[model samples]
Target: MTILNGLKILDFCSLLPGPLATMMFADLGAEVIHIESNRRVDLMRIMPPYDEEKESYIHQHLNRSKKSLQLNLKSEEGIEIVKKLVKDYDIIIEGFRPGVMKRLGIDYDTLREINPRLIYCAITGYGQTGPYATRPGHDNNYLSVGGVLNHSRLKDKKPVAMGIQIADIAGGTMHAAIGILAAALHREKSGEGKFIDVSMTDAMFAMNALYGTQYLGSGRPPQPEEEILNGGTFYDYYRTKDGRYFSVGSLEPQFRKLLCEALEIPELIDSTFNDSSYTQQRFKEAVTDAFCTKTFDQWLEIFNEDFHGCVEPVLTFDEACNHPQIQARNMLVDVKKSDGSTQRQIGTALKISGVEPTYQYVGAKMGAHTEEILKTYGYNQKEIEKLKANGVLI
Candidate 1:
């Protein structure tokens, strides 16, 4: 059996963070029921690259292995249906802003009253309680406030935007999933559930732990690209002749010697490599110039065939999916779409030696399980019809 075989999750979320969190649970065999309204589909449904075969790429990744139900939470009957589902579900995740869920009457207090053991997780930009809690924001704004932007700036230029939605997926969604799991484990011991308030901004703040520690203990202000391990001179990206890049990290003396030998730069041997004052800048320029002499592929072949060469050729997104090391580790897998065309979906980063991850279900259409989900919540056909007639189940 999968890890979360019997767990049930009520996913009243839209966009990336919350849905991706519940998707992680569903991947491990949780029964995730996604709630939506016919008035509007989740914004992800229209995001690209559109799947011509299935008609939606959003459904392809985010909605995988989950069922969907249409319900107008503003309606009394609709709220009642959700409460009934709460009695059976072990967890509920909502990604609405701070007060939106409470306004809909499905807040943690309301749900916990019905099923005291329910693990309720609320994901928001700033959190449930804070000066900025109610402020409107997104991933970029949250991470920016928390110094995530500092570590990602150019070497001697202004801060640049991060490549991925670090705050959304890494800070918010991943933390939400972890909170849900922790709450589930806590429920097993305490026999009661608790509320989990996850703040994307707080998570972003935690990302600067090391930097903060440096500032607090030594009074050394955080440097943009000067940190020893933040891909500084000794550990940074180098461009190649073919417009590709290779990341190198020859931090220690032995590794530095090996790099110098590989580059045929014998004069760099016995150099004061660790001194960041003057030598670091020169070393950075030397490394950059050395790498510019060859293509990325040439450097890759040289490094992979050698030991103690702490260097890696940077791979593009498409190339990364099919990289030899990635394929060997099974980090990419083919997931069959609803239309029979298979798409390459990212494999779980977790590796369990004994149990292999399974493909529980493909992504479902929007509100595809309205009738089935309502029936499970003890709604009869006539009652469901009446609710639908009243514009409550749309």
Candidate 2:
């Protein structure tokens, strides 16, 4: 059976963090109802690289298996509708600045009075209570303030922007999902709900898992090219003869032995264990030179043949998506479009044994499910038309 078969979620999030979190819950079989706004329209709807269906590719991928209700939050009728939804929907995911929900008169304190089982999650850049709580920030700003961007860079060079939204996805999406699930579990036990205040910056700061502890204990700040896994040792990326890169993470002695043997450099195998800076530099240089002797495809073939060290070519996104492992694991799925055709999209990342993820439909247009949802909540056709005519329902 599905894990969250009967769980209901009212999603009031946009962009990445909170939307992706609710998408995960929807993947787990929860009934996710998305609250959309046509007046303020989410930018994801207009981002570049739209599909043939006119919706953005990312919007389709992140918002699959959910229902959308477009409503004007500025109207009292819309606020009353949201309060009515709170009576039955147990979870609410919001991505706004600290006091936006409170100003809307639908904060956790207000909603919990409606249903004590409500699990409200607020995803923000900073946090609900901090000096920078209400500050306008984005993923990069959060990563910088949380100390990740400082150390995740070239030794003396400027920090480059990451290819993905690490703070938005890892900090906000992942942490919000975990917090909501944990609150659901707690509510199951105690018959009470919770208010989860998720700060992307705070999550990033807490993600300084290993190096942060070292700094706290040793009183020395972590710098780029100093940590073992952060380009200090031979555990790094090497360029191939064909300009492609290979990740070399043979940190353990056994793996290092395999790597050195594969490169036909037995002399450097023992030197790999040495902690001296000169020895490490020499080892890194030799490994770099050895990797330069082969092309990207040649290295992959050689590694596949017999080499078992932690070395592999860095595949591009398309290449990784089409790889045999990813294909075998069913990472790509065919989501149903409105016209009964299917569009290939990334499937749910979760891998529960018996619970299969259902992709009902692609992301809906603005207010696509407004009348359908309102009908279920006791609003008849006349009332729904009146609300729509009065600019409450978009």
Candidate 3:
């Protein structure tokens, strides 16, 4: 009854990008059989801070609603089994560096032969081809190569490492999902599958967006802290006396007036119209000094006085989870495990009018659905046992 109900995904995607992309499809009601291996499992499964059930909390969040099928890809029997599954499932997501899947005999070129309508996507650091395509890289390396880190820093300071994996999630995950859906639409009309090569570095390069366009249009690279949103105007964060920070984004005239008036420094309002660097610096310093006089909570109380300004405190994650606005949006929910225990999770942001998101369960035990999935693929209990004996499924 969901948007992606008929979509079937044979996913070999592990870790962040590919897994998250398929997870989105699974959440929206697609059939996702997550391919895993006993010999070489996903590293996320072994990461620390496991829950009381001894399951990795991170895995619970990422792999929900997908069925897991353990297979030893190095084995011939495993390759045959995967090809059999591909005949029924039309989409595949793989995250190997390029050439690995081709060597394993299930690359997009090979699978498309089995099912010409198969939509195959590869999410990699660089892509299928380039001098750096085979290079080993992580989120930071991709961002560095993409020129994103160059303009997102304060003057004369090394760019701080990000708390989140922006390149992996925003870059790869989003692009992979978008490309697959776009290809799915193409397949709908032409009845032909497409190969998607999602490069995280390329996505980050595209994310440069307005600043990058400005640089190309004007023949000048954007400097750190020189752009309005970066810190050029007084549109930035300021620390209060209590050491907590408040974000200021009062860029519009009306909001700027409200902010200055809330700070009891209405005189600063007139000069805000000037976009000159010197004037911006003076305004920034004045706002900084004013913020230093009050605690973050005190400033928050003043802003809450119907200021209607786009200023707010730099809340911690826990605060954000508890905020009234977030609560009002019904963002938090309790998803169940088969045993009746439930985990509190941030639910989907998608708000389709006639469809609801599915949370079948938190990440299942490794290969929890192996027998169930195999039976659907025409394997009997005896054959399943033989595969387990051969170390084909674990």
Clash count of each predicted structure = 1, 0, 0
Better of 1 and 3 by TM-score: 3
Q: Estimate the TM-score of every prediction.
A: 0.94, 0.98, 0.97
Error of 1 at 18 (Å): 1.0
Ranking by TM-score: 2, 3, 1
lDDT score, candidate 2: 0.89
Distance from true location, Cα of 299 in model 3, Å: 1.5
Q: Write the per-residue lDDT of candidate 2 for residues 108-220, one digit (tens) a residue.
A: 99999999999999999999997998999999999999999878887889888888999999999999999999999999999999999999999999999989999999999
Clashing pairs in 2: none
Q: Which lDDT tens digits does candidate 3 get at residues 103-221?
A: 99999888899999999999999998989989999999999999999789888999989988999999999999999999999999999999999999999999999899998999989
Candidate 3 regions exceeding 4 Å error are none
Give the distance in Å from residue 31's predicted Cα in candidate 3 to where it truly belongs.
0.9
Task: Tell me the lDDT of model 1 at 208.
Answer: 79
Please provide, for model 1 over 128-214, each residue's C-alpha lDDT reduced to its tens digit, 9 standing for 90 to 100: 997998998988899889877777676678776667788999888899988888888888899889899999999998877888788
Q: State candidate 3's TM-score.
A: 0.97
**Candidate 3's error at 252, in angstroms?**
0.9
